[model samples]
Target: MSEKKEVKDQFIIAYLPDLDNTQTIINNAICFAKMLNKGLILLYISDKAYKCVSITDAEILLKELSSKITGIGFHSYCAIEGQTKDIINKIPHLLSGVLLVSATEDKTNAKVKEKLASNPDIMLKNLYTSRIAYFISSQNLNSNLPFNKVVMTIDNMRESKEKVLWGSYFGRFANSEVIVYYHNYKDEFYRHQLHYNIKFVMRMFDNFKIKYNLHLSSNSKTFVDYQAIDYAKENNADLIICQTTKNKSWFEELFTLKERKVINNSQQVPVLFVNPREDLFILCE
Candidate 1:
């Protein structure tokens, strides 16, 4: 007989009723947790008020959920609270590598009676923004999400490159493509500056002639934000990468007009925030 391997004690996951991208999110998180040899906690918080749901009934459901995520242990909590995400916020905070795993649906439009039917994405999104007690609180700690590509926005070399590298590394791990939008907003960079930036990017890759998509971005003046979101939407990108860094300095946070627009308007795609140090910026400075 083989001995059961005990999963590590650092992971935690939440399960919502709607289960929109819940499974997808669950699968992704489990893969990450497994790699780190961690166990997970499964939580289900119902926003729907019920006068008859007993603790035993909820436990049965949780037992079923636990079977699916094998070796990943779980628990269930049913509250009288009516807000889902708010309920999630109230789960006991686990220190160490403890994390909150949540899911959100992509709801571009709202229907009259959404609660009557199940829409996975909408359900999860509702949980995140739910008004229930804990959810409304700032209970969720650091979050780790998978992403690839940064719509790296560049107008002049005013933005620091080292800053967004963490995001780029994430993209690399996902084996995804990154599109850097060089803002020739109204006018192009100094001919030499454009040449250097383009050539410099080549040095970062395998030195192969990696193909890039260039946009003159005519509507940048009035709608750079809209344009960036539209591009990410059209391309099916999971997240838009942005970094803030000090001008004429090495690396800093991704803080600027274009970066801000990318982060703010990234609709379905989350924004990855990164900050790099000065030594990382300079070429052996």
Candidate 2:
């Protein structure tokens, strides 16, 4: 049998209706679909029985969402499964041919009281393990603006170079300029490390020929993620690209907390998290 490749190029937006940012997610997904020249798939995983009592209700909601948006039409899928299991079992199959754009709720004191932070970590792990090109859209982002300025944040991690390459790919697709942001610890001992990181990132962008600016933040002792976000916002970034760490052990815990901060901040921009190990096979095809 031939490969079922039709869904491969679709852009999946995991929509949660109870969340206030449903429209933002849809709009962001639409913009991304246009930028990537891919189809849009609006997915809602209904965990509550009351939300979608029958398949008919799911279908109706899908149509309602589709009618509100202009330009590209949406392919809708709603799975009546538990949220945890739904993410684990259905996402891999549903996202077989498409990239994922996760519209997650911004973390706030209210959400914390409601205990929503733990779930986002689970979703993050599932997406990372799937090794797909995925992004977490800021709940407050203005998706209407063009992706003319993209910011890629680089740390000392080995995969930082790959993040730059992915950033360049996105930059080219949107016909936008790429800005590489590197946060260097404010210590003289790390000065050489900063230079090394810059050289590596530059080499990755060498062949892409996409206009890019390299910005370094050297004086920082606390709030690393905040500094990165502040820099992106200062430069009027439309999209921010960063790499996702494997969800395991202390590193995963720290990364999840740090990333959650970046995603929920006042800087409302889509943050694309690429798995460094994943090859550029999808892009080449």
Root-mean-square deviation of every model: 10.9, 4.5
TM-scores of all predicted structures: 0.43, 0.76
Residue 106 CA error for candidate 2 (Å)? Answer: 4.6
Most lDDT-accurate candidate: 2
lDDT of the candidates, in the order given = 0.41, 0.60
Once all C-alphas are superposed, what RMSD does model 1 give against the true structure? 10.9
Which ranges in model 1 have alpha carbons more than 4 Å from their true place? 1-21, 31-39, 48-56, 70-92, 95-101, 105-218, 222-226, 241-285
Strongest candidate by TM-score: 2
What lDDT does candidate 1 reach at residue 130?
Answer: 20
